[model samples]
Target: MKLESYVKLTFLSLSLFLLIACTSEEASKNKTEEPTKQSQTEKKKENQTSLKENIPNAPTNTDELIQYPGGKNAGKSIGILPEDEKKQVHKDLDEFPKITEDASETEKELYWNNLLYLFQEDYIDPQTVLEKWKMESFGSPDIEDPRFQFKENLNVEILLDASGSMNGKIGGKTKMELAKDSITEFSSSLPEGANVALRVYGHKGSGSDQDKQLSCESSEVVYAMENYEENNFEEALNKFNPSGWTPITLALNEAKEDMAEYNGDQNTNIIFLVSDGINTCGGDPVAVAKSLADSNIKPIVTVIGFDVDAKGQEQLRNVADASAGIYANVNDQKGLSEQFKSAQDIAEKWDRWKRDSLSDLDAIKVDRNFMILAFSNDWGRKRDKQNSNLISASDYLYYEKKMITKEMYNYLSDKRDEQKYLTDRSQEEVVSYLESINDKTYGEMKKSIEEKYKQK
Candidate 1:
């Protein structure tokens, strides 16, 4: 009976030992798992905090900040929309080509984010940009002498059209006689030492079909370009008789040759083309004028349409415009004198501008340069901010199981494009102005002459 009791006690001790081993193993498993669970919880909280910090606060009044007014969803948020639906909306908004087909969705998203910032509806005001531009200096120093001294070797050529049209009567006197008288008087009023030449066209043939070719080719420098001589000019005036086709092109070509001896920047050459009709010859006067203007002599070619019709005016005007010259219209001798006076005034104004306007032009150039720099720098800063804001907003929406609408992205993109266009245009305008300063001033001078002398 005692042996049986000892065996039962040993079995009870083995069972206690097995129970303790199982408890220790269970405690070790719990200890290992607790840290992993706590780590996961901490990571999730950190992600939430970061997302909240990244999201920009919604504007109190978007109407003033955003540019999309009266849109169907202008002020509405699309954060609650499904991702697929948002993508479809974006597809609908797509107009111009985006990056490329191979671009990943992340890249596309980044591009959109940039657009949102750059083209925000309410952006940096243009006036603000101007202010910033005004504050900077472009480093254009003043010149000791901006005045352009006039070159004294002045040569003037009078190209008179002696076609049959000039035989017409004005105030009971033949147009030719009146023109000759006017030329004589005008020459007497010119400044001393001025070289002058007389050219005549259409003085060799009758205005008939049989003589058309000869008349068209008839042009002569009756008085070669030289110092003004009253007797020689009078002889030249009386030599031509009006009775043929108007060979305006031939006349201009001959006049150009007459000035070959003194055609250069060291001298100022001017052509006064007096015509009563269009070029009857199959010649391109406009082309001739352009060539003359582009020549080394580069003489100023002013056209005086004497009692011409609409067609003649158009032709003459085109010649003047092409040559960067001026057109004047006159009916009688009195009008002719006034037109000549206007020419004198224009010359004076041109000289004045050359002497005094260089400083003004320099200032304008400096201002334009500063403005361009300001515009470019401002554009970059604004674009970066816009992109950053868009990225944060997009991330926030993604974390919240929301999405940005295609319309929003498209609007931003359009705005960004518009700003870019504006910046480009601003730069282009300044550059163009700088390049055309001299030409523009000359144009103004010509315009003034035309307006003052053109027939009412």
Candidate 2:
């Protein structure tokens, strides 16, 4: 089978399995009716909060349980084209004059409207213009294709600054504490298959000159790169305290070796180097960054200046530029959280776009099938009415001892044939237009993803 067919078949099977499971669960619950009814009665009473009638209810943790006001009315009220508008469209199509080469703008518009009316009859709306606008408004999220060689597991190494400055307060908490909170949330949100590691610098000694030597050499892989778990990560965060001088260069160099085993074009390696000050270890960080950038691991190093001074930011930016990475500056706890959130948001957005696009494609096909079914029903009704009229006329003629003329019978038969021909031709046109739009839609989606994320 073709790849597309295989994918669709797999989805259909999964959907069927879910449906059966739900049906079985419903049946099992129906067998225990008394307890279920009693629990539901009590639950409904407990849910009464006396909120304003006009206010929309808040969505629950599981969105499926939230009841929107108006129920079925909510769905019935919304449409791309209203029922009255659809009737007007049909009326206009029937009355509009045929087009000419020298037709006025109004006539030309009517001609186009008639075509649109026919297409809409099949529930197909050509939305290339709207799609283009959407592409312009939101651009596209970076999405890496799974078919590419870059299919190996993701590896992220966070080089956190544990220098003395991190002990400083931010929004009633130490900077270290804020970083921990943001990182925890970030880690929790990452997709399950990712491998994560934590490296901390300057957590061994005081910032005083006496402890400078120890601090400079304090960069360590406190947690090696491995599948992340909440408890282990929390424990790792608790083990470190901010006390020593900053040793950013050492951190960068260590990160290279930490990810050396996973080096390849197939795997993605990323580094988040967070610091609040310039390197004080008297080593060349820019040169170290350059080396890491040129390593086999090919890490994308993002240097984050966490509430740094102007000079510190400039130095950090230089290191980022040297490594061909991006530099971001965050000043407070909120900024820190947002920066971390953005990292996860990028991945989430790509997944969302793909899923939504697939749903839209399926909806288009479903609408097409529904349109065909409706058209067939309409044709069946006309056929049955024509046959009934013919039989009644023949019976009346027989009762009067007279026969219907052959010419009249042939004319009626021809009308039925013409109706069938018109229906089939219009159906063909609708299907052809839909196929073209579907092709364009898929192309646009592919371009959106490839243009943003496909690696050079």
Using TM-score as the measure, the top candidate is 2
* Candidate 1 ranges with C-alpha deviation above 4 Å: 1-149, 343-456
lDDT string for model 2 (397-422, tens) is 33333322344334434543453455
Best by lDDT: 2
Worst 10-residue lDDT window for candidate 2 reads 68-77
Model 1 Cα lDDT, one tens digit per residue, 12-85: 99999999989999999999999989866664443232121232222223222222111111111334434653
Error of 1 at 188 (Å): 1.8
The Cα RMSD of model 1 versus the native structure comes to 25.8
Worst ten-residue run, lDDT, model 1? 137-146
User: Per model, how many backbone clashes are there?
Assistant: 2, 0
Query: TM-score, each model?
Result: 0.46, 0.46
Q: How does candidate 2 fare on TM-score?
A: 0.46
| Alpha-carbon deviation at 298 in model 2, angstroms | 1.4
